[model samples]
Target: MRAALPGARTRPSARARRERTAGLAFISPWIFGFLVFTAWPILYSGYLSLTDYDVLTDPSFVGLDNYERMVGDPQVRLALWNTLQYTLLQVPLYVLVALALALLLHQAGRASGFFRTAFFVPKMTPPVAVGVLLLLLFNGEYGLVNEALGAVGIDGPSWTTDPDWIRPGLALVSLWSVGAAVVILLAALQDVPVELYDAARVDGAGWWRRTRTVTIPMISGALFFVTVVNTIAAFQMFTEAYSAYFGAGNSTYSNDAALFYVIYLFREGFAELHMGYASALAWLLFVVIMLVTAVQLLVSRRLVYYEGEQR
Candidate 1:
């Protein structure tokens, strides 16, 4: 105590040095792979967006032209409309469904685990397989959906064929895979303080009032987070719509009902080999998403109630 033992500040601990070195060594592969595969392409895509690269002709530097074309393209208009529609409708519907399912599964019950697994099964199935199955289920003639409707003495509309219903049919397929969000919400619901419920009960708060005042405010952050994420996912939907209608670019709809934003961009980039234009469109989509996300963040600050703050 009199000498005040050297505070070990001068020594580099062997374990600390070894751990740092080992971590760098372990993640070197990932760093290298990211640089080669992901980072380079993203950088190059920004460069390519300013050129007219069609693979057949030499990439001529035409800055902003591809972007201009995308701005004026009618297909872009329809694609944006479809993308916005899917996002606005499906995200909210699935978010509400997930919340309701979470509440149901979180109740004082024994079969909750089984219900969770059942809900999650659809999410684990491959998207392509889901698309193929939806084709069979939503098929206009001799399909399971219409067959069941016929048995109930109600006529079913041509879901896949009707221009008005094709997008909704696709939405129905996407809505089936709300399992991940449901699971997340269920976990959040479980995290909510049980004492709050007890307090509410003591104050004579009924189920609806308790949910509205307690469950909703506490879970608002999770709900908003899920909405933003699902909105992004819905905006990027391509495989189901593409497989259902544009496997060969020969759909018979008078207006391209299934012409989703990413599908249109994919056709421009890979199918038509218009890499430059697709890059431009990709950048535009990125900007749009950024703006939307910023708005959500700003708006969420008003609605999303975090714990420990007085609502």
Candidate 2:
């Protein structure tokens, strides 16, 4: 080989430097925004979680006092239990209902497109508006839901006022937004190979058998995605609770049944001004969500069948 040029290494390195500089230049805005908005806030919140920080006073370092308080705090326990209960109630039911709706609508033929739009209208509605509509529909006495029950000679539960009905009422509201998941599942259903169904039918698979094998396994990815997202949303439930009970100064009327984790965190951070404790609560919520998501992913690894991945 000939002797290496003196400038060869320098030229390649210089080109790399230029390319790196260009990449950095392109991403600098996002970097700056993330640092200023997301990363810095997260870091500062972690710091705050270890302190006794009221908005009005300087933060005093208190180690894990905030976290320790969470153990003895009845409200914290109530909020956590209530959140878990809501998650248990909402996520599975929502998934099942959405999947059923998708299945039904997907087979509607000429009416499928129109019905899809109608169903998706609920998802497109603002959360606040949905909350308002829910309040009206489920109002204890004069609400249309109660009125319908009365007409059927069945007394409806006091949805907004009674503790026993609070979570279930909220679950109903949550289910109304299942249109989003329905849309996703519907798209997944559309993408499923028709030949697979034909082959399954030729193999003497009944409708239920075909659905169990061909429909569900094939759409399992979308199901997994929607389930994980809904679980996270269930954990962070606040707007529905706030709208149902706390809005219009009705907090006093409603009991702890509706005091979801994020709702309580909001109360602590903003209402009580326990910034440090609130930060701790926020971090705990973050960890819980991450852990739950990790568990879901792990389980889905065994259950969820990707279209092309080897079993």
Best model number under lDDT:
2
lDDT of 1 by residue, 174-249 (tens): 8778899988898889899999999999999999999999999888988998999988888889887777777655
Error of 2 at 263 (Å): 0.8
Give each prediction's root-mean-square deviation over alpha carbons: 3.8, 3.7
Pairs that collide, model 1: none
lDDT of 2 by residue, 52-73 (tens): 9999989999999999999899
The alpha-carbon deviation from the true structure for residue 27 of candidate 1, after best TM-score superposition, in angstroms, is 4.1
Clash pairs, candidate 2, are none
- Candidate 1 versus truth, CA RMSD in Å, comes to 3.8
Best by TM-score: 2
- Report backbone clashes per prediction: 0, 0
